[model samples]
Target: MHTPDPHRHTPVPPVRPTRRAAALALAAATAAVGLVVAAQGGAGAAVQGSLAADTQFYKDPTSQVVKWVAANPGDSRTQVISKRIASQPQGIWFSNYRPDSVTSDVRAVTSAAAQAGQVPVLVAYAIPNRDCGGASAGGAPDLPSYDAWVGKFAAGLGSSRTVVVLEPDSIALTTCLSAQQQNDRFASLARAVTTIHAANPNAKVYLDGGHSTWNSAAEQANRLRGAGVLNADGFFTNVSNFNTTANESSFARNVLNALGNPGNLHAVIDTSRNGNGPAGSAWCDPSGRRIGNYPTAATNDSAVDAFLWIKPPGEADGCAAAAGTFVPDIAYQLAQNAPDPSTPSQPPSSQPPTSQPPTSQPPTSQPPAGNAACSIAYRANSWAGGFTADVTVKNTGSAAISGWTLGWTFPGDQKVTSAWNARVTQSGAAVTATDLGYNGTLAAGASTAFGLQATYGSNNTTPTAFTLNGTACTTS
Candidate 1:
């Protein structure tokens, strides 16, 4: 997730944390002009190598995945991003940021990502009055023209790889605009989603959800509803910003709960650079933030949809370089040496870090004795192109898990290339598993994790079901 420091610019006071108005205008223009807009949708090459490497580890065929891989090579965390994208069958992204005069060329970009076996991560920001000249600046001029531009923008979608992140900061940062302006922005966004879906139904669209520190669940839900969250596939949170996965997940769940209809809504998180979490709510180019859990598809709760890299990390947010400019040197340094927040500290903690989402809170009233029920969520942290699985297991159950086992079946006939964090051995149709030094002897209502690094020939399937001590988890 990417955001500029509000305090840095005096003109743009940090008023209630709002969306970049330019995104709204961009949607309007795209609607009118059609997707033949311009070529301003792609990212600069600041952190292209690492970002690309992260996406290629899974050996996905998505154009964006391939773009990232083709851009970067010989790095260590390459496999991590690759595995994350490969875990899921599909995803949606925005196009690179280009001007409105040239062709939208959505098909060309989508084809590239599709060929890579992944989806393009598109960012729709060519709106008017974008960013209000704040941290995330630059956008189309006004609403009337924006509508025309969006029309061109929509026309660019190809049949292959594509996942559209429609106008990030468009909703969460609406506080800067008046009610009429807000309404206009929502109407424009609704139009963008409609146009894109109409252009290509396969193209998944996710609206931006403000970071964890920004909005309360109810506030964001109302904002989302006003912005037509129901009309879109799902909403996105933590784009080009900083927040831990655990914190973002919990926050998203809370927002979904406020919405009251999990069936109609899904949420995605930007896990690009949140490994070490945020630094005291600062949004500027702050030091010490490491990459968070790479983008993955493991769903701890049923409501949240997928984790994505909407905000390509290392792409300077105007501070490091031009906003949205992808600087490879800065990106490489970030990937290679981001600050680790979890490391044993020699000083006091600045921000309050929450433990993994509470596994299982004791029931106010116990269920029937024979039906003592508890749920556990498993997050597969490591999985890359070749083959590997290093999963962290959280025993969100009530009873102490004396002995535990985690297992999954691949999509094709893929086999584990290697194993780590736990003991893993494959049988005929099943793979037996055990905890590792890092994840074992999970106390009642505690959490632990383990994984295996494996290699795949040409046929490796995503694990269908995972069992903890023979108990199958609810994976939808």
Candidate 2:
């Protein structure tokens, strides 16, 4: 979600889009390290204060939602959707250059937040070779240019309580760089942390820790150390991904411990889009993911400073729309589907799950290929042209299915427009829904659910026949 501009550096050259397979491989590799290799926050005055009222308004006038709301006020979802998008806090990204105006631009936002008794949360994303020169690539042309830019960035924080999420994917994706490149980056990051606090002694800077599933605690901690995290206020996890708070909190503890548990080092978790955890390993704009914890400094855990909205909802993560472009429809779906923060859901694993033999669970008396019995059921609520539906899948067989797909034909022209908790693809009159990593493996005689929303012209009839994988599911 957070990437640097490749054009600016020129030398780094834009890298290819990250394939899901490659990401999963890295995640698996690092995940194993956290479990087997052994395991492993801070308080500062500048970090003091509640998250400034993020009213997602004014920060980006040209944002997609702004245009959608003004033009479609009569649309039934306008008020709720618009308010949801505008009400939450979004990180103010400092991606573009203009050293002359950078200081003033940042100052204006910080000053406004301070005047309103709120803290300004800024994202200093102008790092060299950010996002491995992918999606959101754009940074200062060179090292000196970056330093000057960060200098101007810190200059804008005029003594107000501030939380800076330094760079996203900057540390986690360093594997894409050469050895020299890595050292230079780490050095610059270290300087950036020092430079920021030097300019505004009241600012608390947080370095990136990738995400719980992305990097091994020891690996990330080593990087944090080399990058001068000891000089920083703390580090943050899950900046742009959807790993849950429980998992992130545990992961943060591990990283801190790996870093020698320095006193007063606190970590922040990005609660922006982790509502449903992750829909499998699908990272870029996967459907079914929802908003998670609201911005709060009251994490109760001393090691965690707050659950922040480092990544704003509605912004496409490259695939759904354009990376960083806020899409009103996607934003509205996430808000509408968000779970009640008060109600406790399935708790995330306290420790990372270790790989085990496939037969950990007792095997069925008679297991056979394609012999899993599966069934699906659907329920929906609709208004106007928009509707949301939840589909439930059940397995009644002697064998468990490692992965499954459900397909059906819409009775009418009703078409799925967006979905979550699963991967959805539609063609003509038929729709195919596939499992995300989280819900892919269904045990025999067990059930799981996924949801989607669709638009209709004159009809919105539910599809009657559903199949699991290729076999038909009997309707209850």
Residue 435 alpha-carbon offset, candidate 1, angstroms: 29
Q: Give the best candidate by TM-score.
A: 2
Computed on alpha carbons, the lDDT of every model, listed in order, comes to 0.49, 0.63
Off by over 4 Å in 2: 1-71, 339-370, 373-476
Query: What TM-score fits each model?
Result: 0.54, 0.64
Q: For residues 217-323, could you state the per-residue lDDT of candidate 2 as single tens digits?
A: 78889988988999998898887776666667877888999999998577877766665565544577777666665555545456776666666666677787666
Cα lDDT tens digits, model 1, 340-418, are 2222112112222221212243122211222112244433322232433335566666766555566666555555533
Most accurate candidate by lDDT: 2
Q: After superposition, how far is residue 400 of candidate 2 from its true place, in Å?
A: 13
Q: After superposition, how far is residue 156 of candidate 1 from its true place, in Å?
A: 1.7
